[model samples]
Target chain A: MKDRISALVFIALGIFFLIGALRMPRTTEYGKYGAPGIVPAFFSIMVVLLCFIMLVRKQRSNSESSSTPAEVKRAENRRLLLASAMFLAYVFLLGKINFIVLTSVFLSVTSMVFLRKRFILTVTISVAVTVGIYYLFSRVFLLPLP
Target chain B: MYTVKVFFESIASTLSNPVLLFHLSWSTLLGILVGILPGLTATLGVAILTTLTFGFPPEIAIPMLLCVYIGAIYGGSRTAIVLNIPGTPANAATTVDGFPLARSGMAGFALNVATIMSGIGSIVGAIFIVSLAPALGALALKFGSWEFAILAIFGTIIAGSLTAPKDPLKGWIAGFLGLMIAMIGLDEIVSFPRYTFGNIQLYGGISLLPVLVGVYGVPEILTSLKRVTKAEVVLDFSKSERKLSYLETIKKNALNLLRSGIIGVFIGVIPGVGEDVAAWVAYDAAKRMSKEPEKFGKGSIEGLTAAETANNACVGGAIIPVLTLAVPGSAPAAVLLAAMWIHGIKAGPLLPIQHPEMIGYVAGSFVIATILMVVFGLLVTRLFLKILLVPTEILMPIIFVLCVVGTYVLNGRLFDVWVMLLFGLLGYFMRINDFPAAPFVLGFILGPMADTNIRRALMLKNGDISPFFTRPISLVLIIAITLVVLSKYLPKKRGEKR
Candidate 1:
């Protein structure tokens, strides 16, 4: 399933690039630098050729290697969903709450959520590092960090 | 006598610059933070900051970039030990051993070891640039398009051969794909249009930024999304005590420092490879050479030391070729080249007369940045580990938003936001397929270098293309490139036999 999907994507992308290349503006430079189309045209062709190679090369695992690729079973769906939620909130909050505040809030919330830390310790460490980073960059480094 | 004047003048100027001092210290801290953050990358930090530093003087600007470069490389191991995610791809090897050590509850010990090695790596890499660069700078006197073509090929081949963990052939295949892609833009010497589709944006060529982000940043996001919270361990700092002295550790592992440093400098001087490859090669060598190879990838202090040290050393190495030939040794250095160009300082072959002071300035700035990285990296390791304690639920979304917003900030255009989303989706998918993204980034970064140089080589002989074989440097590079390709096909042969 995975291999098939990858092959399809590569073929599709190859098409996009090939079309993009052909449509590229015809550029000519003076004094023998040559026309610009040659480079892009070459790249597009290589892309298409490689995509074909990739699709062809998708054989079963090369068993001679000492290590074979393995896919691990994912954890519970709720855990995955919750992790996604936490990350989403962290991002939205960063811009609105101010980068420093958001970062601190994030650090604390994430620590407690992931490590299952106590509240006070979580809050303290998160606030401290965020403040410290802010001070170091904004004040010490005098950077106009956003 | 003239050399002494150049060195002192550069040193004196750097010392007196307040902005340089501030940015040096500040960026080190930021580098650590981004390095510690799983989704945030060192390359991203430098590339993004490239916009902000567009106006700073070249001396200050280059130094600022170095701070992030050093800091980010070291900062990556923080998560490598504490969370095992390896904040940056370069530190992926560190996680092989580092996470095991952290799992053994030696998080502090592992971090401390990483820092000390980082300090050693930076110092040695810097010393290399300071001493050997002037000599090598003179070698550029003999180089031409022939030499440049060979050097870029050498870099592409070595980068591929070294990065793949298990299969050398897979590495070369990816590299060839990159070389082919790099060949897409307009041929440099003759100005013959090669691949530019209809878009003018492409006429400037595929920006390294987009390709790098697509090849690395996106795939990382995709593959990681499913595993974002698995097997995570947040360090309980209160449980761990101060483990080792930085100075003492340095004294014992001086050889690792020197080895990794040499590796870093060599990697850096190459035209297109970067710190990540240097770090891995050094780490692999250190492990193979270690008395107990078994100790590696299990929180072996030496493993963490080798990886961190070598990557940091690459900073100094990346500058050598940039100073002499105007070709950046790595991705960030390529951006550094653009910044230099923006500032009206041409960096390539004519640098001897074009900007005589550049070598000293770049050399001096890197040394200062390395000093700051050590001083700051030591103090911050313990504190950063606590960040690992965050729950995945809360961390991922926040990173998501930053990814979106940061992308938006790039051109203040929604197009970039769309690009970010599209690439993020692509990155996520690539991860699932087991295609390594770093090789792709290496390809994208080196593409223009190969494209322009080969064209120049072809144009020099009016497209005969045969001189590519006759030239010694080009011949060696072609052989290396061939060897890289052949290494991959060997597996197919084995399979056929089976």
Candidate 2:
């Protein structure tokens, strides 16, 4: 189901590019450069044609690549979801927390989760490392950070 | 009369800028340090330095940043040769033979040879940046919208498909996805916004920093999320780790150095492509020509030397397009563009007439930086090798944090924060599905250039697409793109009964 949805998303995107080309204004200059729509029109065609090719290829491929053990597939999906959520959460919090705070927190928390390490060691090391590095960027470089 | 005096003055200006010299040397050493360290890379080194250089004088900033670029590319080979791991993606090819040589007990020799060859390659590349850039810059004055549009399309398609040889179609798909994402922001040239959806922040278009971090860095962390069961630095339990003598290795592979250097320079001169491609291509070429192809994988010094030298040479090659046409030669070169913008020295069509000898200054700086890389590389050899011992669990998070902070700092806006998170999560998901990020970056970098130029070209052509075929450059590129696509699908001749 997910694979089908991904394909549909690509096809829809191709349609979007094609429509954009249609709405674009006609070219005004014509001496040496040629038409304005020349590039976009071609690329839009590329998008749609490539998507269709992908769909055909996907269907023709051996089914075994996708038909892995059910248990392994489920675990894989879960891991992907978890990773995505962590990233999403990190991005959302950056503005609210400010740059230094957010970076330091993200570093510590992520270290713990990814390494499967003990929370105490991860947090302590992450905080020290993050703070030190942030100092180097901010103090040494004098480039402003949020 | 005026031209001669101005030329002499530009030379005089470069010599007079002693403060710039100090900054170049110090920053180059910093860049070498950053590149030699495993967790840090040439791109990150530039990104970190870009912000710092923001406040420096233009003369100081440009030279310093270029120095960092040269130094980092040279330094990257250190980790690649000593450890099995690459310090940067461009250095990845180096490990195919570098670590093997290290395992054979030739780490010191490999490192020294790579540094010397890299310096030589960089010098060759810088010559073009100085001389060829002016020639190209002058020619760029004749370029119009049509040329730009075709160039952008060719850039995305060629780079995307080439990177993903396993499935070139997937590469094009990724490029399209990037173009769509780029489209999400308000249109820059026409001012008729397509995907802004009335959000004020979206009106300006997607910022480069977040996309760069999310696509390149976040996915890296996600892919490496699994904990290694063994301790850090996978122990090489080999019996014969012979350290080769530095001078002996140099005498043995002098031709290899010159060969790799020339290849590296040529690759760097092309707009858009950069060091990663150069290193891989040079290594392949070196091995194909070597007497013993089998030695390439088993710690062959020639392989290690070729990869490092080619990538380092790319620094000079990258500068050619950048100084001449304002088109960056590589991914990090895009970031360098922003730095140039901040300096208020326009690098496009008018660059030659406006600041003619600036190219020479760049050439001189690269030479200095390459020297610094060797000096610093050797000095920090022990420290660089030790970095691989650091835990990934501890390292990946720090990189992620830098990415987040980098996005937030772009404007101190909460909106950018959200953008980074959105892309980061999206990027992480893509990694699991085996999607390559390089195409997306290609699209993001070249999309606007493609859009603006294509439109401008069409505007010139009065909506007629035929002119695209008529132009000389466009014709060649179009044929090249078509051939690249067609060749990917061609099946080997069916069981030729030889």
Candidate 3:
């Protein structure tokens, strides 16, 4: 069932790529062979074919193993989602709040909430790590970081 | 006589410079440090350090980069053995037997064996590079557009199929997905902007560094964060039991060492293939040939040695194609090629002609780097074992920040960071579905070559695809690709009692 859904997603993506390739402007000099869309079109076709095979394989397996493995708990799923959300937010808000400040907050809050750690230890470690990384990149390695 | 003179000259040049020696030694240790940690890969180490070494002279810069590249590849085994979490993808095979050995209170012994085998493998590969690079470069010169196109296809197919031992369909899909992603920017052939919906940032195409870091690093952060409370490392083994009979073991496993090293070098010489493939292939072969095959994967010393030797040897094998043909055998080698370019040294068939001393210098640098790897690997085993005790909660957040900084520092673009995040999510999903990410990486690395070559080949034939089938090398590649794909589907005739 999961494989079928994944295959459907791939098929959709492949079609999208095929459409994009077809819509691309063709150069006159290289004719049909050297068109910029050639490889993309080929790739799209290949992906769709492979996804179909995956769907077939998934179907064949369904008859053999009716039993399914345990699914992730709702709470665990929620945690993963929240972690992803926090990460995206960190990237989005990197420059606005400054590097060290934003990272410290993200780390402290993440460890405290998900890890169920002591707030004081989390905060201290978060601050120390953020500042240490900042010094290493900016001062020691001389790399510019946002 | 000529080889002897060139060899001595290379050694003299490398040893004469105090600065070069320092760079080689220091960068190697730093690289091993980076590789010991989870989330950081050898490719990332080299890419980030390329920026730092940009101001140095080519002589110092190139050696530093090579040392880091070699060191990181060797260092990944440490974490694989001690923690069971491979520090790099190449060490994945090592973890099969290495972690089992560690669990059985043989961590120190395993480290010693890994260190010795890695050095031996590296030296063998280095010898091949110094002797065969020019000849291989000449062979590469014979390749035309059709041959290159076929070679690219072969690489993608083999990499996809090999990366996923259980199911290759997912690997192929991931590889194709990567190729599709590579087509999103401007078309190299026509110079027309592709798939870019008027975004200025999309015009330059996606950077490889950010994609690599995001795909590998982000998934690690997500997974490690979820498992906050993991088992701590146990370092209670006795000093006497930890002592390894290195010379005796090497003598006993001499044939295994030779065979695995050769296999590793062979895999490394193939463009777009990497050390992980080499390690797995060598491991499988070793298990098949072992007198006690039952011991395989259950703390088999032979299995661990085969994996470590091949993966380290692959570093040299990878560099061979990069310097000779301007084609990287692995992801890290691709970055090394870029570093060479940055230092105004053009690689490929013309490299030896333009810079006569380059092959010699590279050979010399690799030898020095491998010796340093052995030295450091032995010296730091106990030290690195302590790092396994650090809680993931603290370590992961720091690594996540480093990933962000590493991506952002490449071109100082916020857009790259966004790309990293996007790929990170995609990579996590891919991993959950058991789709191999390495094939995707290989596809991205080889995409341009595949794209441009196919178009060029077509143009040469005036839209006729016959040459792709008719050319000798192209035909061989097509057959090889067919065999690889069909081998998966071919039913075994085991039950048919004839």
Top-DockQ candidate index: 3
- The per-model lDDT (C-alpha) reads 0.66, 0.69, 0.82
Best by lDDT: 3
Fnat computed for model 1 = 0.17
Ranking by lDDT: 3, 2, 1
- Ranked by DockQ from best down, the candidates are 3, 2, 1
Better of 2 and 3 by DockQ: 3
What TM-score do all the candidates reach, one by one?
0.78, 0.86, 0.92
Off by over 4 Å in 1: A1-8, A15-33, A62-146, B1-9, B100-106, B141-143, B146-154, B165-206, B222-225, B237-248, B400-412, B488-498
Best candidate according to TM-score: 3
Fnat for every candidate: 0.17, 0.43, 0.61
lDDT of 1 by residue, A17-37 (tens): 566556644444532334444
B96-142, model 3: which lDDT tens digit per residue? Answer: 99988988888788878988998999998888888888778777777
Candidate numbers, best TM-score first, in rank order:
3, 2, 1
